[model samples]
Target: MELVEKIKKSSVTAFISRIPKLHLAAVAGLGAILLSTQLLSNNKTPERQRTTISLPVTVSSPSIAPTIAESAPQTNSAAQWRTEKLKIRNGDTLSSLFKRAGLNDRKMMNFLAATDDKASFNKLLPGKTLEFSLNKEGDIEQLSYVLSKLERYTFSKDNERYSLEKELREPDIRIAARTGIINSSLYLAGTDAGMDDKLIMELAEIYGWDIDFALDIRKGDSFRILYEEHFLDGEKLRNGPILSAEFINQGQVFSAVRYVHTDGRSQYYTPEGKSMQKAFLRAPVDFRRISSNFNPRRLHPVTKTVKPHRGIDYAAKTGTPVWSSGDGKVIKSGYSKYNGNYVVIQHGGGVQTKYLHLHKRKVKTGQRVRQKQVIGTVGATGRVTGPHLHYEFLLNGAHRNPRTIVQKLPKAESISTKIIDDFHRQTQPLVVQLEAETATLLALNSKGSQNKAL
Candidate 1:
């Protein structure tokens, strides 16, 4: 029995010596568990003594949490290069521009020869910008040529050669609204409402088929437009397409919403899915006012005699563009004493339109023209008149009023049944928003009036 006890003690000592330093506590606990089990199995130990010899044995593996110093820190690529931006001024050549960036002509020529897309860099326009990223040795390591707000060309240097990469970014489009009430003219009111000329013209063209801006616009007419504002790098780049609009003309409300088809074709339509475009425009030119209307018996300004006026006269500045009302072919484009430079177009379904007293005819005989295409410019070359366009619309053989005849003409095709549901899904929200905004504007105006009266 003595020999066995000595052998057991030596075996435990050898086991303790073999363990790692970090795991000494765990090994000691495991050895205590083995000794307790041996004491419990021996018949010589008393029950009370065995119960009193209590030792809690917990064995656990050692774990060390990683510290910050264990791994390498990450570095930003931009930190390695310094950037220099330059804008090309007028009369600045590529060599001069490169010199401005601290680069010599030899380096410029080397870069140009190494780049495969040298054609785009050949013609550098004024006001375009370029960025050069240099290394610590002041050598051009990267180059970025900004073509526009959304497009740029990047070149990266490797050894003595450079590789080209094109990058394109899409502008962030955000929806916005504008409202205006006409006091005298649409143009003035639109400008007063913080809109540019291009946006005003677009608004007019949207309702051009129904309202003649030169003749039918009234004092109380109001308009609310929902449109897109393109933003890049947290700044507005430009205004995008008009999403929807509402026009209240003399108490008659007209609504138009834009929808983009799956094929990327965009057009305006009413809430009922009918197109807002008609077969003919209500006015062929964007004139300030109408000088004369169609009259069967009227005293001529030049002749001072009773003569039948067969067309509406739009008074505008000379060189004001005149557009074709619909798709047709020019049947006559000539100069005469009464109608200086004029163009007559013959459309399908026995419809024809005539433009008299043009500064210059853009279309020739037998030439095709499309709707809204500029065919001529308003002029005073006729027998007697100022700068005005005499626009005539004829159906079959009888002349018709340009303002009232448009309502009688058929509108462009409506949304097809196959995509009517999709159209509604896209346009319903815009229609609702348009209505809500117009309502808010009306409420504000009413409150302002009440305050004034009080």
Candidate 2:
């Protein structure tokens, strides 16, 4: 009894000395632990015994860590640069664009140059988008141009401030395409699927010579592309070189690849080196919608007679622009009772194109016109319906289906001497990862088949 009283008195002093500031629950837990340890030392107190298990220390958990997670005061923004995009509307110039982007300076003049300054600003096309990334200081860190696809220019900074540097933003093209089905034009489907309009344009240009994009496209047609894709900062920015493409129209699948020979002249090819782009495009204009079909015996909606419709009619708003079929010389630009204000283009290799019922003729006789150049406008000037353009394509002076023109992509040159070294250096890591993942997938696939067999 005297020993127990002396032990209790010593424990009171120890608790007062070290454990007064401890939490109630912690103090109770610690007292129990110590009391159990003491009792464990005594075989006479077996029921009160306890075993202590120590925790392994971790990197984040110190021996004397505080019991709570504390967060620091946050003041700075997380983003160093924020990307922004704006589409060019009519009457928008680079100066206005710069102003809108909060860069009210003469810096754009340094970039546009005097040689093409006025032309660049005045020749604004609608739906063209320009992208820019703004740094924390509100200065433009980078500019992305989407003329066809994205081109980026980065700003360099030394001890002083930032300065823009022109950098070639290549397509980072991968020969690739995806099959899509649409009731209308491939243009509609491509843009709908977030496919870059520039890529769609390139695809059309490549196959312009063979496929008549207007009359040949049908519902349930699927297309595939093996084309170049672009990337910036490991994120896909736009399109690059189109290595190959396949478009299905009216149950026909058309395919082409970029082919470069030993001499360095490149062209779009079939599995064979057949040109996808011919001397002429299958049709002169990408008509908005087909208003009339070629029929041997059908009543004219306007003429009210059972007449042979030799050509196709495309519907568009009045003054909706028309384009030339191919690079050609204007053979005739005149008005006739049957043809109205019409223009005829005589192409190379005995091919010919005709456009009738124009609102106004853009080219005069003997003037040269390139493919996609403005030829005229849609008008009800001829012996036809409301606002529509009558278009015709003749090969050796005979009618062929306009949609059969094969599109040939421009050949992509080998990684050139200038960019090849840099491209390899930049893309090596991604290539390695992609290759490794592909190998892993192959191995797993093989293993799965073996398991299935068993």
Candidate 3:
């Protein structure tokens, strides 16, 4: 038996020695797997004590797998409505603008249909801007159109329905003062002192009853005015009416203040509550000059003989407008051999005005004419030396000098006693402001003159 055992052992040893190194490794791996299975199957072994097994490693580049963060859905927080501003160009309509903005025609039609009577969007002007707010679905949320600095229109969507709103902005009004000295012409001096044409015209009209702007404005004449200026959002928009004005013409001072009564009637009055306007304007026409004054024994320009001149002559360009000196009714508007085209208006208190040598008569017989209304235009159609207006003023069917007769006519009505106090209260501050501004300007001018002389 001992011999047999020795032989068997020797045979096994030989078999084991003949196995290759790779086969030995394979067998060891199988044994390790079996040992791990046995350990995991044991109920006594704790789950925490278990270790993961590793397989044979291949030394190739690893491919990256997409993680949960990369594969998840993305969100855009900035995806919302946006606004676009479009200016109206010539020939651009609301429909065309909407089309260019990628908005549908149906919405525009709906918007127009809703705001048809409430607004006038069809009349779009150049340089006007239209702002539109659109949603993510390209639908208009709000639309705004600015008509002017004071007017605006807006259409907004509320609960799928559009409504139109018209907004009117009232400008803030403030008082402004200006002073001017006439050097050559009122227009030039007024404009040089920061006064516009409209203001200058207004100033002339306020004093039109006494002064003829065409012939009466003289050098060294100065004026002070207090008026209103309108502002919007801290920017100047335009000028308003004059509150008070003081004019010094030919060394004569005239002060006037505008007053509005409780009955809505407004007029200008002096500090003593006397009316600044007269019953008649001194001149019937804004003539360049008096070609012939009221001279009874003057030599006739056409007849070349000593004759009694019945009226004054105003030299002006042909077609120069002739105004009625006062309110009256025309008694005759006819043509004559000696008067060419003429108009005769009879005023209150047996007063009559005759306008002769007219290019054309604008009023007919029996027509009621207001003061300063154009009745005819100057012409040289009659027996005259040049294009001039022959104006005659008659009192009680007798001829009188038109320029001198107007000064003797009835004065304008004064402010009533009931409203005189109110007038003074409102106009006193304006007058004071005007006087202060004028004094300051005069001081500055004097200082400037002295500096120049030095």
Candidate 4:
């Protein structure tokens, strides 16, 4: 109580009482206005705060406002680009893909104009992907088209103009080995051993010159291969070329190793550096069965009279394709009462091949065709009882059995002497691997047989 009475009676209170009440009220009002102004400035809109400048401008005669360029806020040049990805679908075009990605036609046209070569883009296949990078204003800054696992196209903006660039990625290659025994067919055994159709076909082709897979394959035939498998980012992309292979057909063992010469040509060769390819294929078509063999005194199916069946008859589906036995020029591609839709090819060394009773002919007279090229499809035409191919081989105007004659013909050329040492060095390891794998398979088969006998 004593402290309060002393403060009330102090000289500071007497001094304040002598001042005017209007002056005190004016001071208090001024303080309130200053606080309100600070709160309003702190809560200003983003647009107003971004455009606010410290500089003050005066308009002459109060008739002109600031120009848009001078008053607008500058955009951030270092903004991160936004990305969107889209996949190609059937019946999808470049314009449609761009529109689906929220891009305009003008931008797409600009990109196309910048691309010098647009062949890959023109043939846009399904399952490919296109990616776009956009700026803050939704304008394309960068674009990428992934055509396949190996090839890609990129379009980037440089100095306000777009430029296209191509990129290619090489897959990592690793050696792979597989072994299989044939119980019914090579195709079936290959599938059981986890081989794709493409790889199986390639395997057949590698040994086709010596073993006519269409006819020479037996129940106990087996094969071992040491090949390449391509991978990218730890995932297998596809299978590469065969490095080395060993095939046993009808109790005869054949081996081949792939080698690439210094001149960039690649082919399969034997351990002693001999080529694995022959001048001609033994069988021209994949036949199911042999309807008739080469018989001089055979009863014709249609006439029931003794006639010389010069060519071998192959039973197959009507549309089964017939391939040229070797590289040759078509001598005749015509239809006759005896030979329906036949094609005759004249090869080197006085050798000629005749394909009779075809449903459709693919080659014309005088057209040069390579070995294994489809010339026609099998059909039952003139002088035939059913859908079968009558294939004939001629040597110097005399008919010969295709199956037996092809085996006796001259072998393919051997590797050149200059690259023999290089070939041996590169292929020796692959041959060793193939042999090891084959030995392991043989051991397993022997063990299984022994267990069954016991």
Candidate 5:
């Protein structure tokens, strides 16, 4: 029995000595995990704890926002400018305009006193604009008076003083053409062809020396004109001067080309370079019709007796402006019992022109007048029936017909030979444009006629 006990003890001791090192290490690791859990529950962690577990880390840049305190002040150059615009209305005065702009009379006077041309404000037309750029203190940094789309006056605030600058914008000028056929009157024909009143009047004035618009218009008379159309922002602003024109009166073609000379004077000339402007205009006033022609054996309407009517009577409206026929000196301007208000002008080269029965004489007896200058207005102050102008043209003290005398008068100098090539170079393109337009018109008219026949 003692021998068996000793063998059992020895077997137990051998088993303890044969335990593996891997199992011992696993036991030690389990004990370490249990100790770490107890430390985490107590909220006591090491300052530098190393870990073998892999974790995801996202790399990104840090973001910071700016505050309002860092923004620039209103008075600073980087600050935004406030703008205001005001349009001028009819019957608007400087004070009224200023009041509308939230300004006082003193402020307006201060602005006016700063400007050199105060008279420009006097002609403040309606539909103009005034623009203002303001600073932080509500002070005007810049002020602009827009006179037109092409013109403006800018007053910039420089310290305490304001500097004025006139700004002008050049308009885009384009060539335009129109064709008109006269059936009754030139005015009606021109208007039907989309011509404005001013353009029609200018066309008449261009051909006034050769054609009698009031008396010489026929049923088949036609005209073609090339002129300027001023444009801004792709829209038509206004009609400009006539570039080239052609008028066929009584089967006679008369052409006039605009030529700008070296002296900066623009004049119309024939294709052969003859001046279209004669020394005398065809008629003194824009007359509606001839009330009475010159007749030596006609009976006077007032006298009830036979008398010689040396002057032609032009029937026109009262207050119609009468123009000087030529550049001359006024010899007599007075109101008489027979002539009423009359003006007698002595032109050069033994020529004299007389205007009778005027409403008001614009020129004095000694005032030198230019051609086309407004000398008087038509009136009924004379011993006559109604408002009519008794115009007399005297060649060396003999009464001649004003309408026929223009043909015999001296003409203005034509484009000189030195500038004739320059004239042709500038005006030929305009002439070709007119010709092309006319050809197209003719072709269209022919096609329309054929269509009508079909």
Candidate 6:
């Protein structure tokens, strides 16, 4: 109380001495301005005063149990998209093909077995193709197929198993050829005929040196061939082997009998006992400069340094197939970082041969092979200058030219007296059958010609 009185007395004396010049408005205005400034400062948001806080935050993380509320089931792609084709082979049944293709729909099984026999029997044979579709998960979404004989069938699969549906579709036929000229390439001619390159090359291999397709085809040559042209309903699928063919080159005539022997071995033989297969094959390499000619000088293609090449190099196209020069056994087939892909054959009597720089090795070890059989394809494997076949022939551990060894094959021994008699007895009936069939075809053809003439 005494301090307040003293501050009041002092204020009154200071006011009297200054002659009291303060206006009431000025004092009230000053007090009001001070109050307003304090109110504004208090209302304004404070500057974000970040201090270096070193307090450890006891972060309480929420309970994060992985959620599993009705997740979608995983669908398998193997079940979704179909395998596209089922090869109908001898003794193949609907059930078996489906099973082999990994289809497990029981309803489809029962349906295929039940109804279709009366409408169209479900018999499978070689050279036939069937098609099917699958859902996104690779399950049998639908079943459909076309037979080579122009028959068709379809099926459907839902969550329900399978149901049969009959269908009729027109087949598309495409005529193609695989030809080999004695001097010109059959592969080239086949290309002109709109055949697949692979098929045409295969045909040359099937005929091989026997016909000399590259060297034998002449100008104005004529040939007529019959073969299975595959179709998938309205679309053509694949080309099959030549069933029959007639060739006329430079006034010489040739025909092949595609005889599937009862023993399941099929071979192309001349009308006589002579085999179309030669003892040694004609050299597949055509006139490439024989570099280093069976030499002991070793050179590497990459390093371009001295390295022994066991085989002779003959430059050719990549993917050109290499054939065994004679009947032999596959002793080795594999890839080497140095050798590339290679094949070694152990012919009888210690006559071994090796082929290197292959794009692919078709045969494996211990596989018995016939003359001119394809062992591998040519390529620039390992260290090579472009694509070529490196072929080596060794007789009793000595290198020999394949050309030297393969002029003609040595003839087989003559049949024994008893064996000849037995062979004659057995072959006589077959010869008669063959003769009759040949005569019938000729007669029919002659009659048709005469009719055309008339």
User: Using TM-score as the measure, which candidate wins?
Assistant: 5
Clashes (N, CA, C under 3 Å) per candidate: 0, 27, 0, 0, 0, 23
lDDT for every model? 0.88, 0.67, 0.85, 0.85, 0.86, 0.62
Write down the RMSD of all candidates, one decimal each. Answer: 15.1, 13.5, 14.4, 13.9, 15.0, 23.8
Q: Rank by TM-score, highest first.
A: 5, 4, 1, 3, 2, 6
List candidate 3 stretches off by more than 4 Å: 1-167, 183-185, 214-218, 448-454
Ranking by lDDT: 1, 5, 4, 3, 2, 6
Error of 2 at 158 (Å): 12
lDDT of 4 at 451: 100
- lDDT (10s digit) by residue, model 2, range 352-400: 7889999899989999998789989888886766888888767787875
Per-prediction TM-score, please?
A: 0.71, 0.53, 0.64, 0.72, 0.75, 0.44
What overall lDDT, based on C-alpha atoms, would model 5 receive against the true structure? 0.86
Off by over 4 Å in 6: 1-184, 190-203, 211-255, 260-266, 283-327, 333-338, 359-377, 410-454
Q: What's the residue-level lDDT of 104 in candidate 1?
A: 94
Relative to the true structure, candidate 6 reaches a TM of 0.44
Off by over 4 Å in 5: 1-102, 112-141, 158-166, 445-454
User: Per-residue lDDT tens digits of candidate 4, residues 1-454?
Assistant: 9998888788678878887787677667767776776776788666443222232343567668899989988775535778888999999999999899898899788777766656667788799899988888888887888988898888888877777888999999997778899998889999987789889989888877787666677898988898889999999999998889889888888999999877788888889998888889877886667787778787999999998888888889999999998999999999999888899999999999999999899999999999999999999988788998998999999998777888788888898888788888999988898878768867887899899999
The stretch of ten residues in a row with the least summed lDDT in candidate 2 is: 405-414
lDDT of 5 by residue, 1-454 (tens): 8999999999988986787666666667877876886777677556646546333354799897767776644556525657778898999887887777677888777777776667667777789998877776666677888988889998887766788889898899987788989998999999998999999999999988888787778999999998999999898889999999999999999998898887888888887789999899888889778788878787998998998888788889999999998999999999999999999999999999999999889999899999999999999997988988898999999988777887988899877888888988988887888899778877887899899999
lDDT of 1 by residue, 1-454 (tens): 9999999999999998898775786657778887887877875655545334344455899899877767657466667888889999999888898899998998888888777878777788899998999887777889998989899999998778888888899999997788999999999999987888889999988899988886777898999998999999899999998899989998999999999998899999998899999899988887887788888797899999998888889999999999999999999999999999999999887889999999999999999999999999999987865889998989998898777877987779999999999999999999888778767867887899899999
lDDT at residue 325 of model 2 (Cα atoms): 67
Clashes of 4: 0
Candidate 3 structure, TM-score to reference = 0.64
